[model samples]
Target: MNDSFKKIAKTIKKSNSIALFTHISPDMDALGSSMSLYYAIKSLGKKVSIFVKDNITETQATLVDTNVFEKDCNQSEYDLFISTDTPSQKRLGDYAKIFIAGQRKIVLDHHLNDDLKGDLNFVDTSYSSCSEISYQVIKELKVKITPQIASYVFMGLSSDTNAFTNSNTNASSFKTAYELTLADADITNINELLYKTHTTKEIDLKKFLYNNYHLENGICFCLVTCNDLKKLNATKADCDFFSSELINMQGANFAFSIIESTPSFYEISLRSKHGYNVRDVAEKFGGGGHICAAGAKLKYESIEKLKDTLVDTIKYSGE
Candidate 1:
């Protein structure tokens, strides 16, 4: 990755304009990598356009300026299209055509089973968070890591690792945290926003999870229907932490959250402790991610059918 990093740096240095993208339903790792790279590229006096779909979460607004994401752009205008933290074409939403149309393509991701290829690919599953890779790329680009950049990178690293309590956290993650701290990362604010603060809506969602989750055969799971969201006055953001929390159960080896964003449409967020693998389960549903943490979004005929099938899959296959 060292030589590849330098090569990507050279490519960025030569490009006059660049477009940046991340997966839809962006998480902190996705936003942190894209936003930090956007600023780093802009500081080099290059034109930058970033596109992200479904900016429907409050946490997203708190981390980056969603206003900067371009609604439309002629892909031909950019010399390079760089995708960060996005692993597949469908994950790009409608922007896949734009990336395909770019004069050059670069992929910076840390996910498994990638379907989105690039002229310059740097996909490494060893990374704990895409922000760690972004920090290295920013360093290679010779961009000074200001407090703002440090804070953004820190947010992604901490969030993805669940404040470094997750299985993915490693020496590299801690090293990045140390470096970001030296660069004056605003960890205090990020901690407050990500971990400490929770609205009444989130509290209600948590209570519902406590009352509703099913624990069977060492699998703890919850299914939050669209009607549940309406009754609670909450959104998908409120349920983001449910899967992680479920995995924290002492007796559970596998945990999953099935969220119905719309009727007959479900988003599966899977987590596994004790070395159980869930990435294959996500891939079976046409989704892919890390081993311990993975997700897939698909439509089903009914919530009951989806739950039954997913539970059986985990029982017979995911373990």
Candidate 2:
């Protein structure tokens, strides 16, 4: 349970400079909630900075400002570091070193099996998205949610819940959305860019996944290697919805998508529902998330080897 709000608030109140961070290859929930907290904290007259090693993917550019994150962080300038939506230091990617170097750290996450033992922590898996937890943090800080801040929280909530259609969605998700709307959240931008719109490249990737998905033993899975992406002129970001789409298969109990981020490095996203547990599979690969959704990134020597390892691991895990 998240039982340390007073301690977290006290830490923030004492710190003069702050640095904000999130997981590598941040999804909407990761960036949105972190940046919202950045703005809220800055409003309190504290110097705040955001440090991220990766660029915002093309699909994410629709909702996030690319300029909002910096490639480098000077650790000496910040008195405290805050991480959002990230479950572990390994998930921090290149930023893990800087995060480890921080004298004081705070983690606010909703993912299960967390390993980031911050000086201050607030982790609650009961929430559908980290944004909901962030909303509570803002409230505890007594900061009013402005339109911009509400937009971030709302985007994080909507994206993480897949427009409130995922199994994780609960009454609190809608209630938070309602309150954000009253705060003038930019629903139009979120609805249009995140849900309504798609690029030609994304559509092409969708067609590719549709044609290539494998169904065996109630599991439907698909993957795109560097060669596949090169042939399609698509990037990994365009494959964001592949797992979500595969989960729609009528007979499948589990769906997964593996996208090669670079060379032999792969990024995998898993989805499931109706009592199935994909998080268990992800943890086997040193990653974790909600019961119905999870992810992992790994590097392999070859596509064939990667496929073999994944198949064997999933089989061993009884996935």
Candidate 3:
């Protein structure tokens, strides 16, 4: 409906080949939105490729036809490079070069990060999910969104909003929800795959992570070492559902999950209620996201040191 949306539609219309991508360890929203856009682009009889850091999980493998690449293909052979749901170009993982080195790039995202580098960027943190933005793009393009496309968009929105439970859910989100319903997107099917489909390893890892959570000063924290991941045979995607749940604790104003991806380093995921400023907390540690949810990485002598620093950083007035 706006000038930028119309420009994006025209860009997509003219491009013959487009490659869609997301950050590493693609979450449901990232994967869902990327695949949804892939389908919409491919429907126009253009060549489209969907790239991620790794192969799709059994849960999401069925959501799209990902045969464009065999194994993390790095060749940049597309006319248009489109990235979705990612904050930084570096977050593009193996395909970061394709985004940075490519001539034409379009970034559609919802995360609150200032590192957006692209020829045409549609970055809005106000939207609940990148999928919500994707829906608007397709609508502006007047593209025929198939049932499967709508379903993937629904999954992306539902996952990022925590089933519409997060604070970002707004009137636009609900209006998109209504449009998806009109498009005959199976809400039941989407919910079943999202909520009901979980591996035993993921479930066990979540339980272990929750049990290990340490609550102090209105901040809920947990540390999952690499060994913990090996024990659960879980990948980063497996542990994603842990951070938001910790914030669900009735009394806790904030929650943090520090995952030890390697020795002497940890990836910290932060979440908080409406009043707490999580972006400020994440920025202190050189990470960023939304006010309610954000993340940072810390290199420490030990995990204990990381915990101590984070605990001190979170202990502020009006918390």
Candidate 4:
């Protein structure tokens, strides 16, 4: 094992109680790595808890035990704190203070951002997902890949890679998937739940997105207002993956979806095709993610003003 991996493994082994965390708006990759490591450490007889500030969407919760996540962390201290799929402590939301309070902290991530807040950082941008990195860490810990752990890891890998269609996918990712399948992970079931299954409300929102999206200067953008969501009876979960879908539009180098989750509060999801880097766009708004896919949350006075600002930002950035 490499020095970084070895250091992380040694730290985990020495710790008696471990706390795990991810970013604010936790995605499948974040949840997958955190929960998979939770099982691994628990199997080793270590006390473990996952602190998640955000409520997991119903679709993502199906991949693993939702009970594993706690809204609040009660412990005054932990032996070790590990963050997965989170670039910085700021993204940890309310749990940032908890992570800082730990005796030792480690960050396992795949983002290109180097502003790591962990005492021990194991970050590899080449890795397809944080789940893949966690797989390596668990292997070094000598933890057996149980079916349950394998399933969670597989869920993370599939979702973050967009079913292995994103640019980040590589031979290593497929090899890891193969091993997880050998461990009896239910790949078929994961695929159906993540990709195939969607509620009626989700389908209608997608239709609305396609019909109403604005296209200009190689950018395709759409907005889902709070009123629109209320009329369709859709939650934020129904809007997931909409930005990724927009990136598939013909001749569009960049695509974005702005969701008004609450009044004047917007969640922006950005995607890029043809080697464009959406992470730069997101970073400009104080968000950071992968090169092709990134996001940010903002609050504006009005949706019209938000759209105008976003269009100008995207146009100028793309040029």
CA lDDT, every model vs. true structure: 0.87, 0.84, 0.79, 0.85
Selected candidate, larger TM-score, 1 vs 4:
1
Clashing pairs in 3: none
Model 4: per-residue Cα lDDT over 1-319, one tens digit each: 1247777898999998898988887889988899899999999998899988676677887776887777878656577889899887678888888787777889899887546578888888899999999998998899899998998899999998999998889999999999999999889999999889986766787788888888888888888899988987777656867888888989889998888999989888999995788888888877778889988888888877877887788778857
Model 2, range 134-168, lDDT digits (tens) per residue? Answer: 78788778787899889999989999999999888
**Top lDDT: which candidate number?**
1
Residue-level lDDT of model 1, residues 1-319, one tens digit each, is: 4238888888999999999998888899999998889988999999998887675567658867788888787877899999989889989988988887788989998886367888898888888899888888899999889998888899889988889988888999999999999999999988888888886767787899999998988999999999998998877766878999999888998899999988889999999994799888888887878888888999899888988898888888743
Model 1 is weakest, by summed lDDT over 10 consecutive residues, at 52-61
**299, model 2: CA deviation in Å?**
2.4
TM-score of candidate 2 against the unseen true structure:
0.94
Per-prediction TM-score: 0.96, 0.94, 0.92, 0.95
The model with the greater TM-score, 1 or 3, is 1
- The runs of at least 3 residues in candidate 2 whose Cα sits more than 4 Å from the true structure, single-residue gaps closed, are none
Count of steric clashes across candidates, in order: 0, 0, 0, 0
Models ranked on TM-score: 1, 4, 2, 3
